[model samples]
Target: MKSLICLLFLALLSSPLLAQDIFSSKNTHFSFFSSSPLEDIEAKTEKGVSAINIKTKAIYFKVPIASFQFRQKLMQEHFNQNYLESDKYPYAEFKGKVLDDADLSKDGTYQVTVEGILNLHGVDKTYKEKGTITVKGGNITAGATFNIRIADHRIDIPTIVVKNIAEVVAVTVNALYTVVNR
Candidate 1:
C-alpha cells in the first residue's frame, strides 16, 4: 500500500504540465454493451480508478478487465478467457487531455472534447471524443460514451460466436471525483 501511494505521487509529480489541482475517484463506473442480430450483451463494473488535473486538463483512467461482471457466468468466463484474455492483458487504460477553455475550478457543466490514447488488450489506439464535465460544490462529475472496435485491439472472436458479439462495443464511463493529494 505504501509503495502504491508512492507510485501515485510519482505519477502526479512527473507530469510537468499539471498544476497542484487534482481530483480522483476509485469507484468509477464503467460499462459496455453489444447489440447484435444474434444476441445482446452487457456488462458493468465499479472497480475503475481515475484522476484529473484541473490545471492541465489532463485525465487518466484504469480499469481491470476481470472486474466487469456479466449476467451469465459462461459469458464472463468466455470474455476473460477467449475474448479479452485477462490473464495476459489485465487492464484497460486511457490517458488524455480536455480540450476546453472553461475554468475547472468554477461550478458549472461543460461539454468538452478530449483527445487521448486508449490501451486495451495490449493495443494502443488514438481517440478523440466528447464528454461532459460538471463541477459543483467542489466536486467533479464526468461522463462519456464511446465505441470500441474489438478487432482494433486484437480481441478476436471465434467464427462460431461471431453472430453473438458485435463488431463494435459501446462503452460508457462515469466518475465522481473529489479533491485529492492536496
Candidate 2:
C-alpha cells in the first residue's frame, strides 16, 4: 500500500496538467495620458513587471508608482507627492486572466478580453479591458489600452488644479514575454 501511494503521488507530480508554462517580462512598458481643456498630461515608465501562465490563462502585473517620468520635473514631483501619493502607496498591481481560448503556443494574433482587479492608490476596482496578443517564433507580445477614472481609485485632484487634469485617463501597456523555465 505504501509503494502504491508513492507511485500515485509521483505520477500526479509528473502529470502535464500540473506543469505550468509561465512567461515573464521584466521591462514592461506602461504609459498614461490625460487630456483636459487647460492642459495635457502624459507619463511613461518601463519599470513594470508582468507574468502570464499560458496553461491557466492567468496574468499579473506590478509597477512602481514613482517610476513614471513626466515631461516637466515639477509635474513629476506633484504627481508623486500630491496626486498618487507614492510614499503612501508605492505600487500598483493587477491580477487577471485571459478570457479567450486562443492557443498561446501557436504563432498567431488573438484578440482577448481580460477582466481583473486593479489596486491603485489603496483602492481596488474591477475592470474589463480588451487587448491584443501576438505570438511569433516562440515569443509573445501583449498590448492593451484602457481608461481609468480618477475618482474610482480615490485619487483626489484639488479643485485648484481640477481644470488642468481630466476626469479619466487613458492607459496603455505593452509587454514582450519569454518563456520562464521553472
Candidate 3:
C-alpha cells in the first residue's frame, strides 16, 4: 500500500498538462436583428467561430459581415454602406470568455459573463454582457444580447435617414461549437 501511494504521488507530480483549449466553429444557424421605425429587419450569418484557450487567455469569434441576408435590398444596402460598412469592415469579431469558472467537461446550464472587444465599422469597443451556455451531447451552445450605439462604432448616418436607423442597436449573438482536439 505504501508503494502504491508513492507511485500515485509520483505520477501526479510528473504528469505534464497541455493547456486546456476549446476549439469551436459557428453552427449552421446564427441570427441578428436590426429594427427601424420604418420597418423591422432580421438577418443571419451562417459562418462563425468560437475560440478559447485557457492557457493563453485567448478568445475570439468571427462572423462574415457580408453573409447577412435581409429581406429588403435597400435595407441591406444601407447596412453595408452606412452601418456595417461591410465592404471595408467585412467581418465582425468578438473576444472574451465565460466569466464564471465553468466546468466544460460536465453537462449543465451555466450563466456566464462575457467581457470582450467588439470590432465593427473600423472601431473597437469593449463590451461585457451576461449570457447562458449549455453543454449537451458534445455540443456547446451560447446566446447573448447587448446593445450598441451606432455612433460609438464610427458608423455614419445622414440626417435624412437618421430617422430610419435606430440610435441604439441591440445585438444578439448565438454561437454553436463542436469540439476539436488540438
Candidate 4:
C-alpha cells in the first residue's frame, strides 16, 4: 500500500498540471493615437509589463503613464502633466481574463476577447476588447487595438486645445511572452 501511494505521488509531481503555465513580457509595447482636424497626436512606449496564465486564462498589464514618448517634447509634456496627470496616477493597469478556451500550448493563432477593468487616470472602467494571440515554438505573442474615450477616464481637455485632441483615442498593444520558469 505504501508503494502504491509513493507511485501516485510521483505521478502527480510529473503531471502536465505541474508544468510552467505562466508567461510574461517585461517590455511590452503600448501606443495611442489621436486624430483631429487640427492635428494628430501619437505616442508609444515599450516599458510596459504584461503577463498571462495559460492554465487560468488570466491576463494582466501595467504601464507607466509617463513613459510614453511623443514626437514633440511639448506634446509629451502636456500629455504627462495636463492631460494624463501622470504625477497623480503613476500607472495604468488592466486585470482581466481571456474568454476563449484556446490551448496556448499548441502552435496556432487564436482570437480572444478579454474583459477587464482598466484603471487610467485614477478611474476604473470595464472594457471588453478583442485581440489575437499567436503561440509558436513555446512562445506567445499578443496584439490588440482598442478605442478609449477620454471622457470615460475623466481626462479633461482645455477648450483652447480641444481641437488638437480627439474625444476618443486608438490604443494598440503588443507583447512577446516567454514562459516563466519556476
Candidate 5:
C-alpha cells in the first residue's frame, strides 16, 4: 500500500497539470502614449498580441504601429505620416522575462518587475519597470503604470513644436493572460 501511494505521488509530479503553462499571443497587450500641448494623446492597437510562458517567465509582444489610431484625425495622420513613418516602419516588439526568482503561486497578488527590449520607431531600447500580477482560478492577470521619454528612443522632437509636446509621457498597461496546459 505504501509503495502504491509513493508511485501515485511521483506520477502526479510528472504530470503536466502540476507544471506551469505559457500562454499564447491572444493573452497580451501593447500600447503607448504621447503628451503634447495640442493634447494628451493615447492609443492602443488590439490587432497585435503577445504571449507569456509561465514556467519560463518569458514574454513576447508585437504591435503594428499603423494600427494605433489616435482620436484626432489630424493627429493620427501626423503620427503615421511624420513621426512613426508607418509605411516604412510598421511595427514594435518586446521580448524578455518577468525578472529573477519570482514566485507565481495562485491565490495572491504578486508584484512583478519586467525587463525587456522595446523596439519603437525602428529603435531598440532597454527598459525596466515594476508591476503587479494576480493569480486567480488558475489564471494570471498583470498590470502596471509607467512612463517613457520619447527622446530616449531617438524620437526626434522638432524644436518648432517643443512646447506642444512634453518630453515625458505617462503610460498605463493592463494585460490578463490565461494559463495554457501542454
Candidate 6:
C-alpha cells in the first residue's frame, strides 16, 4: 500500500497541471473605433491586463472603462458620462479559453478561435472570435479584433448625436505576455 501511494504521488507531481505554465501581461493594449458619416471616433488604452494558462488553455482580460483615451476631450467625457456610464460599470472584462488546442510552448504563429463571455457596460455577452497568437522564444503575443454592438450592451444614444456614433464599434486587443515564475 505504501508503494502504491508513492506511485500516485509521483504521477501527480509529473502532471502538466502541476507545472507553472501561466503567462501574464499588465500592459495590454485595447482599442475601439467607430466610423460614421458625421465623425470617426477612436480610443485606446494600455492599462489593460491579461493572463493565459498554456496547460489549462484558460485566458482572461480586464480593462478599466475610464482608462481609454480619446483624441478629443469632450468625446471622452461623453463616452464616460453618457455612453458607457463608467462610474457605474467601472470595468470591462473577458473570461475565455483557447479552443484550438495548439501547443503554446513551441515557437510558432498560430491562428486560433477563442470563445468567452465579455462583460461591458454592465452587460455580459458570449463571443466566439478568431485571433492570432505568436509564440517566439518564450515570449507570447496575442492579437484580436472584434466588433460589439452598442445597443446589445444597453448603451443608449441620445438623438442629438445619433449620426456621430455607429451602432457597431470595432475593438482590438494586443497583449505581450511573459512567463510567470511560479
Worst 10 residues of 6 by lDDT: 4-13
lDDT of each: 0.88, 0.86, 0.67, 0.87, 0.67, 0.86
Error of 1 at 24 (Å): 0.3
Q: What is the lDDT of residue 172 in candidate 4?
A: 99
> Model 4: runs farther than 4 Å from truth?
1-19
Instruction: Give per-model TM-scores.
Output: 0.93, 0.89, 0.80, 0.90, 0.78, 0.89
Per-residue alpha-carbon lDDT of candidate 2 for residues 1-83, written as tens digits (9 for 90 to 100): 33432332332232254333677777899999999999999999998888777777778888889999999999999999999
Q: Which 10 consecutive residues of model 4 have the lowest summed lDDT?
A: 5-14
lDDT of 1 by residue, 29-48 (tens): 99999999999999999988
Candidate 3 per-residue lDDT over residues 45-121, each given as its tens digit? 66655554433334566676777878888877878876788889987777665667877656788887878788877
Evaluated against the true structure, the overall lDDT of model 5 is 0.67
Q: Candidate 6's residue-wise lDDT over 1-182, tens digit each?
A: 33432332232233455335777777899999999999999999998888777876788888889999999999999999999999999989888889997998889999999999999998999999999999998999999999999999999999999999999999999999987553
Q: Model 6: how far is 165 from its true place, Å? A: 0.3
Maximum-TM-score candidate: 1
Candidate 1 has a TM-score of: 0.93
Clash-forming residue pairs, model 2: none
Task: Give per-residue CA lDDT, model 4, range 1-182, as digits (tens).
Answer: 33432332232232254347777788899999999999999999998888777777778888889999999999999999998999999889888889998988799999999999999999999999999999999999999999999999999999999999999999999999988654
- Highest-lDDT candidate: 1
Give Cα distance to truth, residue 25, candidate 3, Å: 1.7
Clashes of each: 0, 0, 0, 0, 1, 0
Quote model 4's TM-score: 0.90
Off by over 4 Å in 5: 1-20, 25-31, 36-38
